[model samples]
Target: MRERRRLPRPAKLSVEGESDEFVRPMRRSWTCLARRLRAPPLTALRFLTPPSRRRQRCTPGAAMADVSERTLQLSVLVAFASGVLLGWQANRLRRRYLDWRKKRLQDKLAATQKKLDLA
Candidate 1:
């Protein structure tokens, strides 16, 4: 049978007014500190926590189903407009690139032709 090794426990701090009671030392590891620091503030956490049963019953159908037809149409319109704007921007960039390339090639051809004429 193998003997089990017991890990050392963290040191505890005693409170000034407490007798026979000790508080565990705060973890100082980077991960522990990061978790503590990254935790949402208490006010924000209040909204994130599960709501009471009464509040759940008060709300209507699923959130997605609650959207009005006009809102849906507007959202679709916005999405289509954004897609068109993005495509226009992309084509503009492509045209600029092609123009720059054509100018570069023309300049190179002219330079070669000048050299040939000089020779």
Candidate 2:
């Protein structure tokens, strides 16, 4: 009989999988930093210090109101953006979950049909 040929194993498959999971957090942090770097400098500066101290010669209530107004605007913008992201993520997750469930049910139905045929 002729000798059977064998394929060579990849050198790094196991290690590559482990390293990919290990680097995931670092990649996420880098993306977060990159996003922060790309965002408007004005918003970054406003948040660097407490809002009251940044504005001069204002009464406590007025300072609070100014801070509150700015805070409200920022909160609204963040909420809207995050809401959009979350909604998209939720929709994707729902679709994936439904697809998975449908696949599983089909698999079970197929198995049941096979058993019924054998019986």
Candidate 3:
């Protein structure tokens, strides 16, 4: 099996507008090679806040109306559309393969019956 290389986290501007709140990971020259292999860009941001120390700055209703929520919804819609297309193509390919196999088996059976009749 071909091994997939892990993508290095890209330099991100802090969501809270505090540069010192989050520290970037150390630079590794080897990660440059990993990027050249066409790996997907790392979009997930790792926040430094501990579970107990973290507080919800905005109300739940406000978060739902935020720009981030719209972006997330758009991403989800694109993913769902892509998944549906892929599944349809896969179902089509499976049906074609099954049909071809059925025809081949029927032909083989007919040939065997002819040989039996002649014997």
Candidate 4:
């Protein structure tokens, strides 16, 4: 009777009960863990959080356009001041360059006049 019961158990087994037995379950676990770990932070976060508590994703298109009037005025004032300072510096540099060029030309002319006088 025991032998007869054991004989029918082979047909009930899901597989042939061979070398493939341990492999399938382990492979399935590895694949599942790999997929879970490979998920992006935002995607994995969704699984860890409840729907009601899930944070809204920050979209690049959203902007904070509310600027204070005083900030605008200050920025404009700063820009104008910087422009004035820059213009003053540029004018000073141009004056110095012109003086240097004129001195160089006068020195060259003096040298030529001396050479002509000696000849």
TM-score for each model:
0.47, 0.42, 0.44, 0.46
lDDT of 4: 0.73
lDDT of 3 by residue, 1-119 (tens): 99876655656534465564354333344455656776555643545564686777999888777768679989999999999999999999999999999999999999999999999
Off by over 4 Å in 1: 1-61
Give the per-residue lDDT digits (tens) of candidate 2, residues 1-119.
Answer: 99745444345434533767765665676567668668586766665656564655778888666666678889999999999999999999999999999999999999999999999
Order by TM-score, highest first: 1, 4, 3, 2
Candidate 1 per-residue lDDT over residues 1-119, each given as its tens digit: 99755434445445568554234333344346567659687888466667666646435667668898999999999999999999999999999999999999999999999999999
Q: Candidate 2: TM-score?
A: 0.42
Each candidate: RMSD to true structure? 12.5, 23.4, 21.3, 18.0
Give the winner by lDDT: 1 or 4.
1
Better of 3 and 4 by lDDT: 3
**Model 2 lDDT at residue 24:** 67
lDDT of 2 at 12: 47
**Runs of candidate 4 exceeding 4 Å displacement:** 1-65
Give lDDT: candidate 3, residue 106: 100
**For all candidates, what are the clash counts?**
0, 0, 0, 0
- For candidate 1, the 10 contiguous residues with the lowest summed lDDT are 21-30
Candidate 1 TM-score versus the reference: 0.47
lDDT of 4 by residue, 1-119 (tens): 45422212233324465676755776676567668668487866566655697666765444323556788799999999999999999999999999999999999999999999999
